[model samples]
Target: MKLLLVEDDRSVATAVSAILTQHGFEVVHARTGGAALQALLSNGVDSFDVILLDVGLPDHDGYEVCGKIRRRTETPVIMVTARSDVRSRIHGLNRGADDYVVKPYNTGELIARIHAVSRRNVPPSGGEVRHESELQFGGVRIELTARRVSVAGTAVHLTRKEFDLLALLAQRPGIVFRREQIISEVWESRWDGAERTLEVHVASLRSKLRASALIEVVRGVGYRLRAPSA
Candidate 1:
């Protein structure tokens, strides 16, 4: 797979690039955020499978770069940073990163994370219905195929995770999805801190949907979607 390595530190980039190359990844090393963005934009649609973005970029913050990348493509981004704090992790995820890894990360673990995020982004295969590509319940409308949501006929913008959480719940309205199930489905991993991240995404979805009555909290169990009354 082709991968973009965005890091200003030459020694670190060289080491990581070597590891990735040994594993058969075609690594494109970019020393600055602008260079990375240029590489991404200049390449064809099938260019890069994943991006390893360092938070300490010389020209731009990783968070800003992540947002810009999201605006341009749905390619998976894994933020590589030394910021191990929960707030920083959440912030990176909120900014559209598929995953976050601290500096001094294990090469094996990093490779696994890269594969996990890429797998999650792949479109489902076979005859399964792409559930609710366009769904309308009461005044809320969801277009999963387009990744768009609207409430009371007004468009509502949501982060990537927020939309995924809502779409999962919307698939089976009124069924209480367990917290663990939600996390496994949405985040695609069983990270210890995933529960907290799930909570944050749920809260963000609720706020963006602006239809509190549509999402019901079942206390300690989990959350469920409430369809509009007929």
Candidate 2:
């Protein structure tokens, strides 16, 4: 797969590019946000499978660049930066990043994230049985194909992770999904720190849906979707 690696630091870029190259990925290194944007624009939107964007860019903020890229294409973006704060992570996701990885990260973890995001973006193969593309429970409507959600005919915007979490629960209403399981399926990682991130995403979903009672917490276990009629 072809990947765009956006970082201003030459040494870091070289190391990451070499590692990704060793893993059989064709890496395109961009040392500035302007250059990265130009590369994408000139090469066409579908040129790259995934993009590893640095938050600290010389020409522009990584978040800003990510927003621009999202506007142009649906390619998955993984934010790579030194900012490990919760606020930073949340902000990056809200701005359209598919994943966030902190600096000094394990090479295995980074590769895993790349594969996870890539897999999620790809369509399913074979003629396997598929779930309904659209799911409706109470006033909530989830359009799986369009990746959209609505409440009482009003559209509700959600971050990628927030939508994934809600859609997973919506698929099997009333089924209690363990925290670890949810994190593993949604974030594609079992990192201990992801537990807190999952909780934050849940809280955000509840707030955005404006139906806190829609999702019930199963204390000490996990969470389940509760139909409004129930």
Number of the top TM-score candidate: 2
For each candidate, what is the lDDT?
Answer: 0.79, 0.83
Q: Give residue 50's lDDT in candidate 2 (0 to 100).
A: 87
State every prediction's TM-score relative to the real structure: 0.54, 0.55
Which parts of model 2 are misplaced by more than 4 Å? Answer: 123-230
Pairs that clash in candidate 2 = none
- Give the Å error, residue 185, model 2: 12
Model 2 Cα RMSD, 1 decimal: 13.8
Model 2, poorest ten-residue lDDT window?
122-131
Which has the greatest lDDT?
A: 2
Task: Give candidate 1's error at residue 23 in angstroms.
Answer: 0.5
Count backbone overlaps in model 2. 0
